[model samples]
Target: MKKEASAKTWNTLRNITLVIILFIFIRYLFDEDPFNDRIGWSVLILFWTFKGLFDAVEDKRSGNKKSMVANIVFVIAGLGILLWQGIQFFLYK
Candidate 1:
């Protein structure tokens, strides 16, 4: 019972942290500054890349093929976006 409760508490904390980070990332993405845009988007992409990869492994271990594949795709897309971000700066900036 204690272990279950502790796990729940940790899950709650983790979820809260995710939400806060997401909020900050969104703000950064929407800001007027070009650097802010890059930083914001990078934060989200890095988060998605790392979290998706980690979750993919965890899902695979738990035999959740559907979720595992989804995570893998997410990681791929995040990497793609990061690559694009590296190549060019928009004229608007």
Candidate 2:
């Protein structure tokens, strides 16, 4: 139980940090005014992260495999978005 809690905490923190970094890079490094765009992207990230976590927890409660593959796919998608945004910032700057 404790181990599972720790893993959950870690995943949440990691997702949050990635979101923050993506926001920062877009705001400062890119120097592009993505005010509304930033908000939308942030919301999307938050939604996906929370949804994945909830699904995982529900699966666990039901004695399933916790949807590990789906969770990982979402995480990877989030990271890929950040990377693409970062590269666009660099390339355009």
Candidate 3:
């Protein structure tokens, strides 16, 4: 990979790791509370999807093909998980 792509990849990984840790911390804080658990999950999923959308838009404007593709993947995966979790949360509620 080019140096730019490598650096971008590293930053993306770091950001994703931080988001996971934040979500875990929040989940622990609201542990075993049904409504709060759903809110936590929704917040994390929305954060990820929105992050992907913004990144993809920026990369597209900058003409970074690879990073744009990766961000699109993230957006798709995030939305898929969001849909799956939404159904479960609704049914439980």
TM-score, per-candidate, Cα-based: 0.57, 0.42, 0.62
**Superior candidate under lDDT, 1 versus 3:** 1
By TM-score, the candidates rank as 3, 1, 2
* Superposed model 1: Cα runs more than 4 Å off: 1-34, 89-93
Clashing pairs in 3: none
Best by TM-score: 3
Report each candidate's C-alpha RMSD, comma-separated, in the order given.
4.2, 6.5, 6.9
lDDT tens digits, residues 35-91, model 3? 676667676777778778878977997899999999999999999898988898789
**Cα error, candidate 1, residue 23 (Å):** 11
Worst 10 residues of 2 by lDDT: 24-33
Query: Model 3 misses residue 83 by how many Å?
Result: 0.4
Can you list the residue pairs that collide in candidate 2?
none
Model 2 TM-score relative to the real fold = 0.42
The superposed Cα distance between candidate 2 and the true structure at residue 67, in angstroms, equals: 1.3
Q: After superposition, how far is residue 13 of candidate 2 from its true place, in Å?
A: 8.5
